[model samples]
Target: MKPLVAIVGRPNVGKSTFFNRMIGERVAIVEDMPGTTRDRLYGDTDWNGREFTLIDTGGLELGSGIPVGQVGLTGQPGDLMDHVMSQAQLAIEEADVIIFMVDARSGITAADDEVADLLRRSTKPVVVAANKADNAERRLDVVEFYGLGLGEPTDISSIQGTGTGDLLDRIVEALPPASEMEEEEDENIPRIAIVGRPNVGKSSLLNAVLGFKRSIVSNVPGTTRDAIDTEVEFGEQKIKLIDTAGIRRRGRIGVGVEKYSVLRSTRAIERCDVALLLIDASEGLAAQDTHIAGIIHEMGKGVIVIVNKWDIAQEQIRAEREGIYPDPDDEIQSAESYRKALMGALKFIPYAPIIFASAKTGYHIKSILETALKISDMRYLRVPTSRLNEVVQEAVRRHHPAAVTAMKPLRVYYATQTRVNPPTFVFFVNDPRSVHFSYERYLENRLREAFSFYGTGIRIFFRARSSKEER
Candidate 1:
């Protein structure tokens, strides 16, 4: 865990925009509308040789969130504004330093004053940032924010990328000294991102795994805006779980929040050591589900297919079995058949472990963490060089590559384990092209069969041997 720094402001003050600019990606949704950001978005960056985590929060307004006793998170539902304020309040409570973003173009307003008044009561250091300062006049107008009495305001253009260096320097100065920060244990923890279509029980599964309702859970789609990272311990092993916003289909994704979600979800996959691809049990598997699976495959990520909301699907089936369902046209299938069909649809990742779970009921919830740890171990499993070549030789003996027009069959000269975490293997061969796609897949399968490389995708590459190596 790094020192937490939060960005706070009124609606449409370019808080999300400035957050995106600072993190060097559009992780937060940037719209002209107020209250666009409803959850805490987090990113890590280093400035002046110091690394810290930045939190992008929804705008602060009057009576923003629920009272301190009542929170909108977990299973409790709230109005959109209530959720926004609740998220912003959480960001404020977790920050080691707060960056107060005000609008330079709009000048200091009542909303800014309201936010300033709130921060003034906090003991944490506050740095005022006047965003949207595009020109000399706008920059000069930034001085008006000084009336907030927090500190001298820094003029910055979140879009144009100006005057941000000074902002970073100021933020660094406000951060607690290096000695007080949490130890750098991020690299050692295995990150597993729970990803899938909207309302597929991704957040529910997260809450179940942690035995608490930490993430915002609602029936509404796109409820979880940011890729929320939560760290938990499974016995002695510490793991980071990222409950990412839904990865909606490309065509249906709007140019606003949904678009930002898809990007962050994909980024979550790229960063994680393993992914839990949650499928709605009631919905079975949708085309969008496979699309997300394809992404996990292409990224060479370790994956586990979780059929969530199994309780709902089972109850519906029971009703149909009792002839209680009203709609005669709808046929109910057995859970076994559903599992087979779902597994069959994901042939590309046949090695992935599948579990039917009800996040609401805590059914098979314990297995998820245990299975994730087992799979994460495979990602780092390095086979001995000797054992790798032996498996290759046996695989080739059983089924060799087809001969190329009058040419000798492809010779497998040697092989070596190149890397782990999506274990990659390199083989020196007579001709790289001779190892066809099917043959490559066969070798991967054989490796898995020999070593039980469960729940992780493995890579194999054939390379021609150099002259000296040929000797």
Candidate 2:
């Protein structure tokens, strides 16, 4: 799990501006978690080699005119201001390290003092950042923050990108050691995650696959509040299945355990080797379903689309078999027809194989296991350098890359597999920019053809040939 870093301060304190620069500079993990209402406030970043998630307290504003001692993080929030402060306490409670932002020009205010008191009471590691310290005069004013008693403030200009690097260095040092939070997992076993929208039969599907009631099935949405990990033996193989809470639409934390449940669902995707994406067969696919699939593809995880509640879908199909509503598009009324439309809807992840199954009756339950095992093998499949280069050279010979400029066309000298587990391949090319997006897709298709990577998303990278290699 990545360490959680909270950037806390009063509103207009440059927290959002600072957050954007950190992630926009490519110094962060750019893969987004869809449907998060706090998307802007939450960002995944890394300094040196240590990656951590940044939680911006931009929305946690303490309204003006409130006295220092009157404000409190206790009890449930009443008004909008109290609601925002309640969220601030949420960040404070979950963060492994805190980055307290302050304005150098304004000096310390009552809000800043209250925030400092909140941090001091928690006793967590705090790194003070004095924003707007662009000039020598403002830099001198940074000392006023030291009086807040957090520590010596790091002077920075979030807009100009001055002193942010040193501030990042301090933030990295203050983070808890990486090993302390690492949860060990068995590499030999194939870890699978059952994920989809709420009430889509994710828990029920897990129970069907296990041939027993493992997760509590319910009609209510967002029933499971946390990730449930269970290890069991299927046939001769031992595998781990992670059942997570349902993710609500629009990133809204409405009722009970909203934040914790959503966090668990996203974290489950991060740790899984293969994701079993369940979709409702009766309602077909929706926008939220595709959003979840997009996140899975972006993470480069092996995925198998399970159309849950097919039994219910069959009942609906039976009613419409006589062409009650004639439609040319959906001419055939069978699984084959539904599959064609399903593939069209999920054209982005065309590589993922879809399985139509019912969680109630245990239909096609064995095939799910078989396909998952096959995908696990495909994710870790490696091709030898000689065979890879031969395939690449043949692919280029068949259809040469289009010329981006009149002077130089794209030329690939050699290619090799650099990593496995969603296998990544690196190609030494004459010019990386000359390779277009469509050409990359063509290459990926050819590689999939040669290697038969059915359900796993593979990675391909192109880099300029080194001068030494050119010689």
> Per-prediction TM-score, please?
0.61, 0.81
lDDT of 1 by residue, 1-471 (tens): 468788877678898888888788888888887656655466788898998878675543224333222334433444544434444455556578988888899897765676676778878889899999999999988888878998799999988989999999999998998887744546668999999999998888899889899999999999998899999998999999999999887656543345457667877897788999999988879999999999899888889999888878867886767956545343234656876897799999998888888899999888988999898888989899988888889888899789776556788888999988889999899888676788888888899899999999888888998878877
Worst 10 residues of 2 by lDDT: 28-37
Residue-by-residue lDDT tens digits, candidate 2, 257-331: 456566668779988889999999888888888888888998889999998898788778657777364464442
Error of 1 at 378 (Å): 1.2
lDDT of 2: 0.80
- Local distance difference test scores for all models: 0.81, 0.80
Steric clash pairs (candidate 1): none
Off by over 4 Å in 2: 25-41, 61-85, 102-124, 130-149, 152-155, 160-163, 179-183, 210-217, 248-264, 320-333
Candidate 1: global Cα-lDDT?
0.81
Task: Give me the candidate number with maximum TM-score.
Answer: 2
Q: Which residue pairs clash within candidate 2? A: none
